[model samples]
Target chain A: MATIEELNKDYSKENNILKKLTSPGGLKDKITQFQADLDLAVKDFKEKKKKKEYALSRNDRATADMLEKDLETIRKNVLDLRDKIQKASDFLANQQKIVDEKFEELSKDPEIKQKLDSILYKKYDRKKKAELNKKQQLETIKQIVDAHPNIQKWLKGIEGYEKSIRKCDKIIDKYKATPPSTPEEQKDLSDAIDEKNHSTKSLADRRSDLVDYFAKNHPEIDKNILENIHSYGNIDRQIAGCEKSINNYDKAMDNLSVAKDTNVVNQTSPSSLAPVPAQKPSWFHPIQRLKYSINEWRARRTQNIEPNPIEPNASAKSTFLEDVKLSKDEYNSEIVQKYLNEQYQENLHKVARQKGNDSNERGE
Target chain B: MENDFINITNEDLEKLSLEELADLKIELDDLVSKVNDMLKTCDDILNKDN
Candidate 1:
């Protein structure tokens, strides 16, 4: 059995090679290089044709003939380059498939699988921690905002305006429903319309005030809280990315295991190598049609059965009231600067922690 | 002619041990380098002045 140190070393070595094999500068680049060379050769042939024309204009048949021969050689070489490019492209595709398979095999090894899992887990763990921290911070913010009487009143006031606007909308609808038969009715309808517009304008103003209050009074707290709230989406994306990588690893392993089982079955039963006959439809039988329909329904149901996805933690569930959409101007306010500074510090701490983890893994 | 080259699939590679995979990687690297060199030579020949 390999020790942890030996396993780590082997994993790193193999991982590096795998990275190189898949890198842009690897075998794939050869095809690109060949195509580029072919383009240059074609361009050169065009220039040579111009030279041939000039030679002909001077009545230099020998020179013209020589240039034409050179052109023919260039044309032949260009064709050969194109052929090489095609071959190289096919070769790269074949090799890439092999490399991908090798990678899958490497990942399936117990030690390598553990190493890969640990790396993925660490990433997922970090994002999960960040997400939890953000949630807790948001909860604290919510508590503080909820506790404050003035903030509560302001929020209520904003809600009141929204409610009033809705009420005004109903009034407007009532006024709009009866077509004004007299000048007095028309004046009443106009007044109602004007009132609704006033309420709408006030609602906008009130929301803006609330935003300004947060920016001015609780800039740091509000910035951190709102920024964190906004960043839940980003963290979710990062976590999902990590999950996808881990899922892909598992999927590859599953495929390998399935392949192995199939191979074993094939080895055990030589008769299974023969293709099964296709089912023939009997149009004369109603019972057979019903059975076929039932089978088709079952197949469709099975196809529709998707695996349940991983759900976000309870803390990540946000309320409608908490989904505050910051305006462009507000997002770019002093709060943004504070948020950016806080993010920079957080990133620095994360990088330092990552470095420490790397060193610890290396046993340095 | 290309078919003459050994066509090792995923199944073939899966059966090999880790050490053999590593050795195979080295051989692959050497082959890739040779191909690259051949391409470079072809590029030079194409670009060469008469």
Candidate 2:
């Protein structure tokens, strides 16, 4: 059996491989890149075909045919690569489960559990410190923005617009709930909605101005940070979210202990400790024994029988080419037909110009 | 070709001869095979205990 440290090392190594196979610039990305290349090749072929260049020369036609074949083969290869990646991903996932089980078993030891707890506590401490530093940074930004009168005015305008919009919303909601029966009430609701819309537009304009102000005067400050500066409620919500995540981490650690207890209980449970029943004696019944022997012989005979081999269809040779031709026909019917119509219109215009030119010459 | 397969462009593919396209297909096949080999190695390592 592998030790906990060894298992952890192996698991980490496997995870790196999995990351390489799935991360950006990895096999998945490479396949997507190849697919993009194939799409481009197909598009180029279509353009060439549209220009009737493929029919101009045997070499061009051969190249087009080769492009189509290569495209199909590359597409199949991409799909095969995707399948292989999926299999590798699944295998890695299973490996993760095995490693987790091993870790769970090892963690049952008090020494290991203590070490894990200390590590987790240290991580939690670091996270808490990071969050505190972020809060301090946000506070400093807020202070700087508050000291700037122009930005403060912009924030105040936005706040006033938001407040008026909220009031309008309340009026609108009240009218909608009771449903205005009188013309006066209807007018009141419509007025409220118009006012709300005006305020919303004004609010958006103010926000845009604020963004512009930051761009011109305070290009050093991040626009995103400036946008969030006035929204203390959003800052509070973010803090709450962070706290919730930390609480969840704590819960998970507690659940680990609970899980260990459950495992222990399950190991000693009645079902798992159930005794195995004795096998049936052969001498109990002759008639039943003969029936069993006949059934076993029949099973053996069926297992020995060979299945008939399937014959290959001779006509399947041209199927791929036919499919390619069908696709090309579909393409031509849509895009090439449009091109032909344009050419016909241009020819008609030329003929009309020729007639006008001849008439002028005859008159002169 | 293997090193810069990702850099292969539409214009490049468009200009390639039939024989060159065939060669590209072979390169793609080799890339897939290499990835498969890596996967197999990882699998062997993971299942060594089993």
* Model 2: per-residue Cα lDDT at residue A33: 46
**Positional deviation of residue B13's Cα in model 1 after best superposition, in angstroms:** 9.0
The candidates score, on chain A by TM-score, as follows 0.25, 0.31
TM-scores for candidates 1 onward, in order = 0.25, 0.29
Superposed Cα deviation of residue A286, candidate 1 (Å): 56
Model 1: lDDT of residue A271: 39
Pairs of residues at least 3 apart in sequence or in different chains that clash in candidate 2: none
Candidate 1 per-residue lDDT, tens place, A1-364, comes to 9999999877665444444444566443544445445444655676798899999999999999999899878767765875675575467557656855776766878888554444333333333334444444445456656667775565555555655665566566876787777898788777777877887787667656556767886654445444222111223333343344444434433443233444433333323222223436455464454345445644764577445422323321121113323344544556444544554565567667777887999996
Q: Pick the candidate with the highest TM-score.
A: 2
| Candidate DockQ scores, in order | 0.06, 0.02
Error of 1 at A266 (Å): 46
The DockQ for candidate 2, computed on C-alphas, is 0.02
Please state every model's RMSD to the true fold in angstroms.
Answer: 34.1, 37.7
Candidate 1: DockQ? Answer: 0.06
